[model samples]
Target: MAVVIRTANWHSERSAIRSIRDAVFVREQKVPADLEWDTLEESARHFLVFKDGEAIGTGRLTADGKIGRLALIKSARGLGYGAKLLETICEHAQTLGHQRVYLHAQQQAQGFYSRAGFIVKGDIFSEANIPHIRMVRDLDFSSG
Candidate 1:
C-alpha cells in the first residue's frame, strides 16, 4: 500500500497525531504521558502519514530544526514509512531555510536514523528512562 505524508496542523490533526504518539511513546515504550506531549506542540510543524485512509505514522519539526515525536504503528514500520517521514520532514526544514536537522534517536532506532543519513553525535543519554543518542543530518541545499 502507498503511504502519503503531508503537513498537518495541531488543531485539525491533533487526534490522529496524538493517537500514534500515545500508542508508540506512552503505551508501547512506557514514556510518561506528561513528557510525551508538551507546549511546544502549538508552534511546531506536524506531519502525518496515512495508508488506505488510516493514520499510521506522525512526526514534527521545530523552528530550530529539531525533529521529534516521530512514531509509526508496528505494522507500518520496516516498510519505508519511517524513511519517508524523515525525508518529508527534512525537505520541509530545507524549505524553511534550515541547513541541518537533528533528533534524539532512541538507541534501538539509531541504526534506522543512520540509514537515513543521520549521524550519531553525543554520548548515550537517558530520556524518560529510555536510552537515546543525538543524531544530526545536514540538508543538501544544492538543488534548492
Candidate 2:
C-alpha cells in the first residue's frame, strides 16, 4: 500500500479538500461550519492523499506556516495516511524555510500527533466545541 501525499493551492483542488474536511469535521463530528473554516484556508497549502487514483484524505498547511487542519476520512484511518499527510506538511514547511511547526490537535487525537513526532505542550484547550491541545515539532534535523 503506497501512500502519495501532494500539495496544491485552494483553487487547484478545493473540491476534494472540502469533501474530506466536511466528512471528517462537519458531518461526522458535527463541527459547525463557521469553526471548520478560517481565513487561513485561502492561502494555505492543501494536501490531498490518493490511493489507487481515488482521493482518500486531506490536510492543510497555513499561510503563516502552520499545520493543523488534518482530517482523513473514517475509513482511511489506521492506514498510515495521517502520518503521510504530516510528512507532506513538514516537507512543505521545509520548502518554505519554517523550522517550527505547530498544531491545535483534538484531545483524543493527541496520541496520533505524538506518534507523528509532534510534542504535546501546554494545557488542553477548546476548538469547535471539542477539547484540544497545542503540539509542536521542530524540523531542525541538524540539531538531532
Candidate 3:
C-alpha cells in the first residue's frame, strides 16, 4: 500500500476532507451533522491520507495546537494508517512552534492515542453526544 500524507487547503479540499469525516463520524458513528462541522475548519491545517492515490483518511491541527477531526473510512482502519496520520499532524504542530498539542479523543480511542505519546489529562466529558476525554502530548523539538 503506497500511503501518502499531504497538507490540504481547506478551500480546495473541503469536499475530500468532508467525505472521509462524513463516512467515519457522521454516517458510521452517528454524530450529529451540526456538531461535526465547526467554525474551526477555516483556520485549521487539514491533512488527507491517500492510499494508492485514493483519499482514505483525514485529520487536522488547529491554530491553537488542538488536533481534532481525525477520521478514517472503515476500509482503512487497523492498518497503522491512523498512527501515521497522527504523527504527521504532530510534526506539523512542532513546525508551527507549538510546545504541545491536545485533543478531545473519544473514549474508545484513548488507547490508540496513548500509544502515540498522548496522556489522558482530565475527566471524561461529552462531545457530539459521545464520551470523550482530553489527551495531550508535548512536542519534542530536540530532533529534526
Candidate 4:
C-alpha cells in the first residue's frame, strides 16, 4: 500500500488525528484519557499518515524537539509508516534548527526506533503504565 504522510493542523484535523491515536493509545494500549489528550496538542507540530485517504497513523513533535504520541493502526504496523512518520518529524526538526530529536519509545517499539537511527539514552521508565525508554537521534545537517 502507498501511504502519504504530511504535517497536520491540530485545530482543523484534530478529530481525524485523534481517532488514530485514540484507537492505538487509549483503546488498545489503555492509556488514560486525561494523559492521552493534553494542552501541548495545540502548540506541537503533528503528522498524519494516510492510506487511501484514511488517517491510519499519527505523531507529534514539540518545539523543544520531543517526539511523542506516535501511533499506527494494527494493519499498518511493520509496513514502514512508523519509520516514515519519524523521518518526516526528524527532518522537519532539522529544518527548524534542532540538532537532535528525542522520544520516549515504548519498550516493544525500541527496536523500531533504533533502526531509524535513535539510540537509547536512559534507563527504562513507565509512561501511561507502559515501560518506555528515552531515545535520541542526532540530525546530521553537515551535508546541507
Candidate 5:
C-alpha cells in the first residue's frame, strides 16, 4: 500500500497535521476546537501517516512522554495505519530517553491502546465532554 510514516514539527507540517486532526477530532468526533488545539504543538514531536502517498493519520509525542492528538480520517480506519503511527511515536519517545509513555485515550479506544502494551492507570475522566482514561506503556530500552 506504500504506507509511510514521517517525523515532523508544527512549523513544518502544520497544515497536514491539522487537516487530519480536523477531520477525525473536530468534524467527525465533534470535539471542541479550543480543546483540540493546544500550546503543546510548538514543542511536541509529530508523526504523520500516509498511505499510497496521501496523508491519512497523525499523532504526537510530548517532551514529557505524553502521547496525544492521535487521529485518523474516517476513511482510513481499520486498516492498521493507527498501529504504525503509535509504534513510531513510542519508538521516538524511547530514543528521547523517556522511560515510559502515557496517553489519555478515549474510552472506546482503550482497547486499541491496550493491545499495544498499554495499561489503564486511573479512573475515567472527562475531556472535551468525552470520557477518557489514562493509559501508560513502559519503554523497553534494552532492545535498541
Candidate 6:
C-alpha cells in the first residue's frame, strides 16, 4: 500500500499523533502512561504517517533535533514507514542545524534503528519496563 509521510506541527496533528502513539506504545507495548505521555509532546515536532488519509503511525522530532517516541500501529509495521519517519526527521534536523539525532530505542527495535544508520553507543538499560539502548546517528548534511 502507498503511504504518505509528512511533518506535523502542533495544534493540527496532536490528537492523531497521540492516538497512534497511545495505541502502539501505551496499549500494545505496555509502556507506562507517564513515559508514553510527556512534556516533550508540546515542545516537539511530530510526524504522522497516513495511509488512505488515516493516521497509522507517528513519531517526534524534538526542538534539539532528537528523535523519540517512535510508534507505529501493528497494522503498519515492516512496510518501511518507521525508516521513512526517521529519515524525514533526520532531514528536518539537518535543515535546522542539528549535528546528530538521538533516540532511546527499545531492545527489540534496535536492529530497526541500526538499519536506519543509527549506532548503539551504550549498553542496554530499562525504561518503562522495557530494555532500551542509547542510539545516535550523526547527520552530516554539509556535503549536500
Q: Count the backbone clashes (under 3 Å) in each candidate.
A: 0, 0, 0, 0, 0, 0
Better of 1 and 6 by lDDT: 1
TM-score of each prediction: 0.96, 0.93, 0.97, 0.95, 0.96, 0.93
lDDT of candidate model 5 versus the reference: 0.91
lDDT by residue (tens digit), candidate 6, 3-54: 8888887688788987887888888888888878888778888888899889
Give the range of the ten consecutive residues with the poorest summed lDDT in model 2. 1-10
Candidate 6 residue 127 C-alpha distance from true site, Å: 0.6
What pairs collide in candidate 4? none
- Report every candidate's CA lDDT: 0.93, 0.84, 0.94, 0.92, 0.91, 0.86
- Alpha-carbon lDDT of model 1: 0.93
Most TM-score-accurate candidate: 3
List residue ranges in candidate 1 displaced over 4 A.
141-144
Q: lDDT tens digits, residues 1-144, model 3?
A: 698998999999999999999989999899999989999899899999999999999999998999999998888899999999999999899998999999999999999999999999999999888999999999995874
Model 3, residue 121: displacement in angstroms? 0.7
Model 4 residue 90 distance off true place after TM-score fit, in angstroms: 0.6
Can you write out model 1's per-residue Cα lDDT over 17-61, one digit (the tens) per residue? 999999999999999999998988999999999998999999999
Compose the digit string of candidate 4's lDDT tens values, residues 76-134.
Answer: 88888888888899989999899988999999999999999999998999999999999
Question: In candidate 4, how many Å is residue 113 off?
Answer: 0.5
Native-to-model Cα distance after best TM-score fit, residue 141 in candidate 1, in Å: 4.7
Once model 1 is optimally superposed onto the true structure by TM-score, how far is the C-alpha of residue 113 displaced, in angstroms? 0.7
TM-score (C-alpha) between model 1 and the true structure: 0.96
